[model samples]
Target: MTGRSGGFGDHSLKTLEESRKTYLQSLRVSTADATFFSHQNALRKFFSWYSPTANKPDSPGNTLAEFAKHLLTTLGQSVDTVAGHIHSLLNFLAFHHQSSPDELRVRLFSEIQLLSCPESAKESLSKEFGFQAGSEITRSVDALRAYLRQRQYGTRTHAYVELILAARARPTQIRLLNRSDLHLDEQTASIPLSETYLIAATGLHNEQTVDLPPDLTNVLETYIEHERKTPSQSGCQPLFTTIHGRASVGTLRRSVKLASEKARDYHCATRETNPDDRSPVDSVTAVVPSDIYRVALSDVENTS
Candidate 1:
């Protein structure tokens, strides 16, 4: 349900356009020419988006949420900008004797207000938020760091390790991430944009940038250039790819779990062979491979 106005090869969309024009004539809205033009354009867009499918009738209900998401993530429009478009949409719905988009508009408007907040304000809000405050863990962050530093890393394995270490992302997040999403030069990586809006709505984050460490950036570059496949080769252009497409969650999980296990084993061997060794190794070796969760929990605490 997306195309240029009058470009839909059918008269129904054209009929909708005529209907919209009639509605505007009847609306007596206290708006200027520019505002009227904007509303007209918004109507055109909505009809274009709501045009019937090949085998099915037009179902605006099925597409409204999707359209809003496309506006937020794909178009990357400011919340206010999108809200303006939605207001016009409400008018269009009213004209059609359809239920207004009030609830959906409220949700979309809330999301926009969140995105519009200053970065400092977002940080302040997160800090002040008490609902998500997590219990403090006893895990040693230094130990986690040491384990990460000592682990062996092939180009592919290293990329996953570094991203998880830095992103604190779940294995599921890797496959959803596109090759184009990594911002190496910026030293910041965005999580999936689809996830970002939800994050903002939930007040977990402000949809601002998330930082990536230099070492992680370097590894990702090496993997993308040397190891990852192009879309033509794999059918999906993901930063991390398998023969099929994006790396599967299992594949991503296995590498980290294996690496962490290896790190723990080495730590255990060191502690056993030299029980009293006065090295950072003693403190670091206490954590098991399974302790990765505690590390992630710690990151969530620190960031939130």
Candidate 2:
């Protein structure tokens, strides 16, 4: 707040409004009539909920994340809807960055690029992106599974991905898991899908558990022994932790976003119908973390 502080400062109300107006004016130059209006509408929706907190020092990475989740859960917005809103917010961040002091650009710009558009799609790719149906959700999940497994960091993040896609764990639940919480035994058991041990993961309800497959059990073991960093303090071990101790919410979100992006083998048209006749139809232009994220959120809601 004192001097830009390297990234967008929600702590300052005056600056946030000024920055929004400035960005909107600049956005007019690059965006068409529809695009510009759409973004303006999104910004209005955001400002309706965002009340500036005074002197609340927080990381931009984390603050923006909470803002996004609030839009989804509290505001009850869908992934694509939230994505459109975030896309607008991201541009505002970038535009503000350009006019801010130079040193702050590096960190501010990094947040912009990381949060911008979830994942990059080539211009050569077709438009029209979203998870249009429950079946499309399935396909996207499968694709994301494979993509996460193939990445080098995948070894580290793959377990959480499985928990999300298979077990339907929320980000908060994943963050709260301890290394010891996993009921993994060194001797592999021939467990069936339905019979696999429950995760005992704490969520909205305290007694939550989920089925874990043998392959994923192995992956968890490998991660614990090889990929995971040893905790400095005796009580610090988490089921999945970054070098920073615990995976930040932003890290978890971005990991899911990357997986979703990679899952898109080809760009979809600007509009396309869901092929499933059984489920209600929707046309989506992009797949994002929320597609995966909402599963866990809904799971908790249903169970609760």
Candidate 3:
């Protein structure tokens, strides 16, 4: 009947208008005095819909239980979330009215019990209540790194994962490395080598003038001359470069992974075949093993 053309007569509409004015004034007063403006507004709206008498402290048919239920249903919140909100509202109302928490209605009292528990305990209880937490080991840092490394990760990409793992273990710093970080000298050759070459000469780190076996030295010299030459082409870096002519972390990671896999494959194939076997030639045993190749280089340097 509040200023509407309904079944109510003019007298009823006038009473409704007066009630609306009084309710608005009450809301304004409560909003001014309320500690939380949001809570005051919500309570004011609820009171307006349920009870129009503003001056009375107690309103007929105003129950905290019904209000809590209405709030939860209207908000479409989970049980735990609804319980927390109701508990907060109950506490706020009790404090505003200068009453004890115990004086709150049963619905809010029950919610307060649920909210008072420690978060860890509540999670445990929730699990016990059949709320399963989503968890997977496949998404772990190590697992993801391994997968990416297999797919040929670049240097920068590997560095980032390494940083994350290091941080997880303990706080640490990652320093950038450059070619200058490597110690290189003509006098000493700490180059890695294969077992066959190591058997021929003793290895030393940063040693000068290691003699290399003539044959191995010649092969190495040829390889270096052909493959390690300074590029005549513009925009090319010999030490490292991407297909597009730029060094990248992903490219480096992928190269190392591919190299390792090739080495492993060669080792396995050689191990399975007999050197004295008269069968057709094995492709794996035909290629130089990483260890043997490295030893050949060391032997060449040592003999030379």
The 0-to-1 C-alpha lDDT of every candidate, in the order given, reads: 0.49, 0.50, 0.33
Cα error of candidate 1 at position 243, Å? 2.3
Q: For candidate 2, write residues 156-260 as lDDT tens digits.
A: 667777665444444455556777666766422111111111111111112234446677787787788788876555665776677667777788777667656
After superposition, the stretches of candidate 2 with alpha carbons farther than 4 Å from their true spots are 1-133, 151-154, 186-205, 265-289, 293-304
TM-score against truth, every candidate: 0.43, 0.40, 0.20
List the lowest-lDDT window of 10 residues for candidate 2. Answer: 195-204
Tell me how many clashing residue pairs each candidate has.
1, 9, 25
Candidate 3, 1-304: lDDT as tens digits: 0001111112232454454444344444543444345444554544554432332213111234344445555654456644444443444343333222222332233232344334553353233222111122111222334443554343433432332232111111112222222123321112221212111122211111222334323333333334333435564243333334434444544543454445345444544585663433222221112222222222221221
lDDT of 1: 0.49
- How good is model 2 by TM-score? 0.40
